[model samples]
Target: MNSLTIALDVMGGDKGPHITINAAILAINKEPRLHLFLCGDKSIITKYLLEHHIREHPQLTIIPTTETVAMDEKPSSALRNKRDSSMRKALDLVEQGKAQACVSAGNTGALFAMAYCVLKTLPGVERPALISALPTHKENKNVFMLDLGANVFCEANILYQFGLMGSVIAEQVDGITKPRVALLNMGEEDIKGSDHIKLAATKLSANKYINYVGFIEGNDIFTNKTDVIVCDGFVGNVALKTCEGVAQLVYRKLDRFLSEHFFARIIGKMLAPALKKLFKSMNPDQYNGASLIGLRGIVVKSHGNASAKAFEAAIFEAIKEVEQQVPEKITIALEQGLIEETHTE
Candidate 1:
C-alpha cells in the first residue's frame, strides 16, 4: 500500500471492463494504499463495479468516456478519430497529474501512437521504446530488453538511448547495478549486425555509466551473460515472440506427453509438486506486463487475452514502476550522462 494512483483503461481488454475491473479490484485488495482511476464508458464500468460491490469504493474513481480504440484500428485513425477513447483518457490522467501511471490491454499500435502524442518522450529521448522484463536465466531475475516494435527502424542514437533507458529500468526495478548490456548480433564479433547496432555498441562501450558487453548472439538472450539487450524494434519483437512461442510449445508437448504415456503420467504425479513450482515460475502470466519505457510517464501494456490473475500481475508491474519512480530515475540518469547523438541528424 503506497500513496499512488494508477489509471486503467477498463474498456480496452479482450474481455472489456470485466477483466480490467476485476484486476483493479484484485490489485486494490492486495495493495491497500493503492487507488485506481478506472476510465471507460461510465454506465458499463459502473455496472460492473456495482456488481462487484465497489461502485462507491473510496479507493476507486471512474472517469467517464464514450469510445475505445479498436484492436484492428489504424494508428492514424486511433490518434485522430478517437479523442475520447478510454485508452487515451487513461493516459490523459497521468499527463494531467491525476495518476502516477496508466495500464491498458488495448491496441499496441494505438497505445504507442497515443502515448507519444499525449505524454511525449522524456528529455534527451529521441523516441519511446517498448520494453519488457523478461524472465531469464536465474529464478526471480529478469532482463529488460527494449525497442520491442515501438520503432521498426531505429537509428544508432535511438539504439543508444535504449541502452540508457534499459539501464535505468534494470537498475531501478530489477535491482541490477551496472547491468550488463549487449547488442544483439548474428555473431559475437564486432563484424556482426547492421551498422546501426555496431555504432550503438561503440557508443555504449565508450559510455562509463553503462556496462556494455559488446555483441551477443541470440542464444545468449536467455543466459545470465547479460541483463539488458539492445536492438531495433524488428529484432527485439521477433526474439520476444520466438521465445514465447517456444515456451508455449514446450509446455504443450510436456502436457501431451504426460497425458498420452501412462508411465510418464505416473512419474509426473510423483514429480507434480516440483513440476508445479517449475510451471509457476515459467508461466507467461507471471510476466504479463510490458513497460513502454522512455516516456515521460509510466505506461504498461498487458497481454490482450490476459485473465484476471494475469492482468493483476500487470497492475502490480505498474505499481512497482510507480513506486520506484522509474521515469524520474531515467531523467536523472540522462541528466547525469546524456550521451552525444553520434548518428547523422
Candidate 2:
C-alpha cells in the first residue's frame, strides 16, 4: 500500500491533546505506512511525545499552533477567528495537499464549517453530508447511513445527491457491488412521506448507478435490508441518538435481570463471553469515525468524547478512505448519475 499522510487536530476534542496525541502514537505504531501531522501547542504535544519515547519518530511531524477551537465554540466564530487553530491548520494541510486527509474530534458545526470553507465541495455536490457505518443484524455486516446532523433539512436534489454519495461509500469502502440504497421515512409506502422525499425517491430510482431500494422505516435500519440509508440531518441524527440510547438501555436491563437471581447469575457467568462479544459488536466506540462526504478532500469527524482507542479507529478510517480514493470516486459517480438521468429524460 502507498504511504498515507493525515493531519490531526490535537487540541480540538473534549479531552484535548492528551487523547489525540496518544491516538496518534497508537496509529503510527499500528500502520507503518501512515504518517501524521499533529497540529497543536508545541509544549503539550512535545510533552506527550517525550513520555511515549517517540518524540523523534520518523512517521510523525509536529505542526505547532497557538489556538484551539473549544467544544462550545460557535461555527461562525471558529471560522472567522480561528484561522490559526489546530482544527483550521489541520484542514489547511489537506487543502495544500500536504496531507491526504484531516481527522478531528472537534465541534461538529465548527469542523463542518471550516472543512467546507477550506476544501469546498466536490463538483456537482451542492452540500456535503456526514456518513457513518452502523452494525447490522447480519453478523459481520454493516450498513452505511448518511446526513447524520450535517444539514437540518435538504431539498429534493440535495437528498438525491446524498443517496449517491452514500452509495459510493458503501460500494467503494465496503466493496459492495451495486449496493442497495434507501431513504429513511415514516413509512415504506410511496405516498407516506413529504413531497421532497417522494421527489428524491423518484430521482434515486431513475439513476441507474444507484440500486434504489425505496423507503425504509427506522426499525429496519439494522436489518441489513439495504447497504445505504439516506435522510436529512434532523431525522438521521435523531435516529442515531435513539439507537445509542436503546443499546445502552438493553445492556443495562439485561445486566440487572441476570443479577437479580442466583440461577440467572450462574447462567450469565456461563454466557458472559458470548454476551460480551455481542455487545462489543454494538459498541459505538468502535465506530467512532464518521466521514464528511461529498467534499474535494477527505475529512473524518471523530466522536467528541472519544477515548484513545476510539480516536485510533478514526485514524484508521481516514487511511481506508484515502486508499480507496473516496472523494474522486464520489465525483465520478455523481457525474455518471447525472449523465444517466439526462439520458432517461
Candidate 3:
C-alpha cells in the first residue's frame, strides 16, 4: 500500500504541540508507509522536531495555522471567531482530499461543529456520531459504542442511524462479519427502556442487515455477548464516565494495598508482570481515538488528556479506517438500502 497521509491538529490537546510532535514521530516510526501533515504554529513544531533530532524527515510536513481553538471555548464561538484555527485547517485538508484522515485531541464540541460545516455527513446520515472502542472481558477485544455525547437529543430514527453507523464501524475495525447489535437499556426485557429506545429496537430488529441482539444493560457492555452497543449521547456518555471512574478507583486501591504491606509487596513483585499486563489491558488509554463516524471523510477524536502512546493509537485508528474504507462502506450500504427498501422511508 502507498503511504497514507494524516493531518495532525497539534495545538488542540491539553498538553499542546510537544506531545503531538512526539506522538507523530512515534507513529511515523511505527508505520513506515505513513505521512503526517502537522498543522500548528510552525516555530513550535520545528523546535520540537529539531530537539528530538528529527527535523528533516521526508514523511513529515508542517502546515502553519495562526489561531487555535481554546479548550474551554464554546463550539459556536470557535466556529464563528476562529476561522483560521488549526482544528479547522486540519479538517480542510480532508475536505480538499489532501489527506486521507485527520486526528485531533481537541475540544469535541468544536471538532463536531467544524466537521459538520466542512465535510458534511455520509449519505442518509442525520448527523455524525462519536464512537470509541471499549476493552471487553473477552481479552484482546473491544466493543464499539456510539453517540458518546454528540447528540443529546437524538430521536428514535437518529438512534437507529447510530446503529447503522456503529454496525459498519465494528465490522470494519474488529472484522466482525455480522456484529451483534444491542440497544442500551435499563433492563434486558422488551418491556423496559423509554419509548424512543423501544422504537429504535423495533426498527433495528426489522432491519435485515443489523444483528439486533435484543437489549443489553450497562453491565453487559464490557462482555463479549454484544459486539456493538447503541445509545443516545446522554445515556452513553454517563455510562462511559461511570465505567472510567470505577476502573480508576479499583486500580488505585489495588496499588495502595500492594504498597502498604511488606509480604504483599513481595508477592506483588513476583506477580508484577501479570499484573502489569492486566492493568495495561484495562487502561482506558488503550482505547483512545473515538471516531466521529459518518463524516464524508475520516475524522478521529482523541481524548484531550491522551498520553503519547494513547495519541499514537488515535493515529493508527485513522489509518485503519482509511485502509478499510469505512466511509465508503457506510455510503454504499445506505445508498443500496434507500433504493431497494422502500419501507425505510
- Model 1 residue runs over 4 Å out of place are 270-286, 339-345
Q: Taking the tens digit of each residue's C-alpha lDDT, what string does model 2 give over 1-345?
A: 438999999997889888999999999888899999999999999999989876588898999998999999999999999999999999999999999999999999999999999999999999999988888989889999989988889999999999999999999998999999999999999999999999999999988878999999999999999999999999988888888777778878988999999999999898889876676556553356889999989999998988898899999999999999999999999999899989987
Candidate order by decreasing lDDT: 2, 3, 1
Q: In model 3, how many backbone clashes occur? A: 0
Candidates, ranked, TM-score: 2, 3, 1
* lDDT for each candidate structure: 0.85, 0.91, 0.86
Q: In model 2, which runs have C-alpha deviations exceeding 4 angstroms?
A: 270-277, 280-286
Higher-ranked by lDDT: 1 or 2 = 2
State the displacement of the C-alpha of residue 261, model 2, in Å, after optimal TM-score superposition: 2.1
Local error of candidate 2 at 178, Å? 0.9
lDDT of 3 by residue, 1-345 (tens): 447999999998899897889999999999899999999989999999999887698889999999999999999999998888889999999999999999999998999999988999987998889888787888688888888878787888888888888888888888889899898999999999899999999888878777789899998988888889999888888877777777778778887898899998888788778765665545453446788988899999888888888889899989999999999999987775555345654
TM-score of each: 0.94, 0.96, 0.95
After TM-score superposition, the amount by which residue 219's alpha carbon in candidate 3 deviates from its true location, in angstroms, is 0.9
* Model 3 whole-model lDDT (C-alpha atoms): 0.86
Candidate 2: residue pairs that collide: none
